[model samples]
Target: MKLTRRLFVGASAASAASLSAPMVMGQARPRVVVVGGGSGGATAARYIAKDSQGAIDVTLVEPSREYYTCYFSNLYLGGFRELDSLAHGYGTLASEYGINVVHDWAVGVDREARTVSLAGGATLPYDRLILSPGIDFVDGAVPGWDLSAQDVMPHAYKAGTQTALLKAQVQAMPEGGVFAMVAPPNPYRCPPGPYERVSMVAHMLKANNPTAKILIVDPKESFSKQGLFEEGWQKHYTGMIDRIGPDFGATNVEVRPDTMEVLIDGVAEKVDVCNVIPAQKAGRICELAGITDGNWAPVIPHTMQSRIDENIHVLGDASAQGDMPKSGFSANSQAKVAAMAVRGALTGSQVFPARFSNTCWSLIATDDGVKVGASYEATDEKIASVEGFVSQTGEDAALRKQTYEESIGWYNGIVADMFG
Candidate 1:
C-alpha cells in the first residue's frame, strides 16, 4: 500500500489509540526486536510491521527519541540545510505502523534465550533480532583524542549537536586561521563524507574568512571522488585547501586539544579548529552481543543474517558485508532485504531475491554537486558490484546544479521512506 503522508498520519492516530487495546486472548504473534532506529533499523521495523499487517510484533529500541541523519549533514555545514530539517521522530512508526518504539539503549543480547536487555531494565523477548547500531570510534584511533576531547575538536561525524558545534567553530575562526581535518582510513562510513565535509567547510570559510586555510591529513593515499573534489576546490576556493596523504607523513599525526596544535609527521602546527574523524568499528552493542569479529560483525550477504547467530541479522555499517560502502542508502537497501527475509521466516511471506543499490551525492559548493553509484547482487561469497558510474572531473554547470537538485529530492524521498 502507498503510504501517503495524510494516510500515514491517520493510521498513526489509529495505532496510537489502539495501543491500550487488549491483545487477543490466545493469539501468539512472532516478535521481532530491532536495535538502533536509524536508517536501517527504522526501515526494517516499518517494513516488517507494514507488510505483515499486524501478523508480527515489532519493537524498535533506540536510545534517542529524535534521530539526526548523518546523510546530508555536510549540506548542513555548507548552509544548504537547517539542522532541524535533518531531525526525525518515531511517532509515525509507533502510531501509524504499529511499531513499539522504545527510546532506550539496548545494552545486551542473549542469543540462546533470544532476548534483548535494555538499559532501562526491561527485557524484550524476540524470535528474531535486527542489529543496526551504526559506527563507533576505535580507541586511540587519533592520538591524544577521545570522547572527552570532543568538545575541543568536534568530529561531527554523527551529526546533531556535533555538526552545530563544528559550524559554530568554523564561523568563529579568526582571520586567516587554519582549520585542520584528520580524515579516516578506508572502509569507513560514507567514503565521500570527509572530502564533502572539507568542501562544506571551505564554502563556509570562503564566505566568512576568505583567507583562512584548510588542511586535510589523510591516512589513505586516495579518497572518493578525488578528481572531482580537487577540481571543485581549485575553481571555487582557490589555494584554500591542502590535502596530505600517507606519502606526506599524514599517517603519523597527533593533536593537542588544549593548545589546538596538530602534529603532522613530528611537525607541530597550531590550528584554530580541528576535526578528527577517528577509525571506526561496529557499534559497541554488537561487540557486547558477541557477534562482532573484533571490528565488525560478519553476515551472510544474501539475507543479512549474522553468521554468528541466524536468529539475529546485522545491517548497515555494523555488518561486514562485501563490496558495499557503508551509507544510509546501503543501510536502507539492506534493511528492506532483511525485512523481507525476516517476514518470510516468521509469517511465511513470499521472499524475493536480494538486490541492492547505492548512490552517494555530495555538494562541492552552492548548487555544485557530484555522485558515484553502483548496483549489486548477492553472490555466494559477497554482494558484488556489477556496474557503476561516477561524476566526471569537468562537468557542465547545469549538470552539477541538476545533480544537487536531485540530491535534495532523494533526501526527501529517503526520509519519507524511512519514517513514514
Candidate 2:
C-alpha cells in the first residue's frame, strides 16, 4: 500500500497514542531510523514500512544512492554478471513505502538523546535505531597495506568501484603472470567469498590467460567448504592455483602494493595483481555510537536488539549474533526478525519466535556450484544452529547446475525483497 505523509499520521495516531511512556508519549507516530542500505538495513526498512502499513514513520540514512550486493559480486568479477546488475536504488522505498530515504552518512549516534547525526548536518530522531553498517577494515591487519593502497591492491569486499577495479586489473594481467589474494582470518564476511573469488578469477584466466597462476595466502587452517573448493579448484583450474595455508606461513604475510608483490614467511613473490581482504570490524558508525564491545556490536538473537543499548538494534555483519555466518542470506534472515520486533514494539503488531536460516552459494566454474547452509533458532545466549546441509563432494553434474540456478533465483528474490 502506498502511503503519503498524511496517511502515515492518520493511520498511526491511534496505535502510537496507545504506546507506553518513554517510547511514543504524545507522539503521533513511532519513529524508526535505519542506518545503512545493504542487505540487512534495506530489508528491515522495507519490511517494517510495508508490514506496518503506514502505522510507523521510517527513515533510512544511507550515503550511497546505488547499493551493490557483495554476495554475487564475484560473479561480476568472473564475467557471469555485470556490476550494474548488483545495484539497487531506494526510489521504491521512498515513493511506495513512504519511507524518508536520506542520502547522507550517519556519522554520530547520541543514544541518550535518541538522535543520529548525519554528515549532511541533519539529526534524525528515532524511538528505535537499526544499524546494519556492514564492515570496515581493521587497521594494521595487513602490514604495509592500508586504504591508501587500495587503488593498487583492491579489497573489493564492499563491491562497486573496487569490484570493477579488481576485475579490470585481472583482465589486464599479462599472460603467465601471477594473481595473488591475501585472504582474511576467521569470522569474516562470506566465509566462501575469497575462495569463490579465486574460482572466478581462475575461470577468467583459464579462458583469457591460460598460463596465468593464482596464489592464495590464507591465515585460517580450515575454511568453510574447504573440501569442495579444493576439489573444484583441482578439477577445473588444476595447475593454475596454489594456496598457502597456516601451515605454510599464511598467517605471517605482508603485501607490497607499490611493487606488486606478496611476502610469505619473509619471502616476497612478484605479482601482477593483488586482492587483499583485511581483517574487518563493524562499520565505524557502530564505534561512534559506543555500541561495539570489541569489533562488533552484540545483539539479542530473539529481537536483534543491541545488548549494549536496548533502544538500538544491530543486524548483519555488524552484529556479533552467534552461530550464523556473516553472509547476505544471514543478514536478510535477521532483518525479518528485527522488522517483526520493531513492528511489535512500535505498532502493537504480533511477534513470533525468531527463526533464521542462511545459505552461501559459490560458483567454482560455469554451471558448477556448491553451497553450505543451516537453520537457526534464537536461544538466550545466541542464535544456535539447528540443522545444516552442504553440497556433497561427488554431486552429479546436473545437480551442480541446478544449485547454480538456485543461486541466481535467490539473488533475484533477495534483491526484490530487500529493495521493493
TM per candidate comes to: 0.94, 0.96
Candidate 2 wrong stretches, greater than 4 Å? 1-23
Q: Give the TM-score of candidate 1.
A: 0.94
lDDT of 1: 0.92
Please give, for residues 156-181, the per-residue lDDT of candidate 2 as tens digits: 99989999999999999998999999
Q: For residues 301-366, could you state the per-residue lDDT of candidate 1 as single tens digits? A: 889999989999999999999999999999999999999999888766689899999999999999
Which pairs in model 2 have colliding backbones?
none
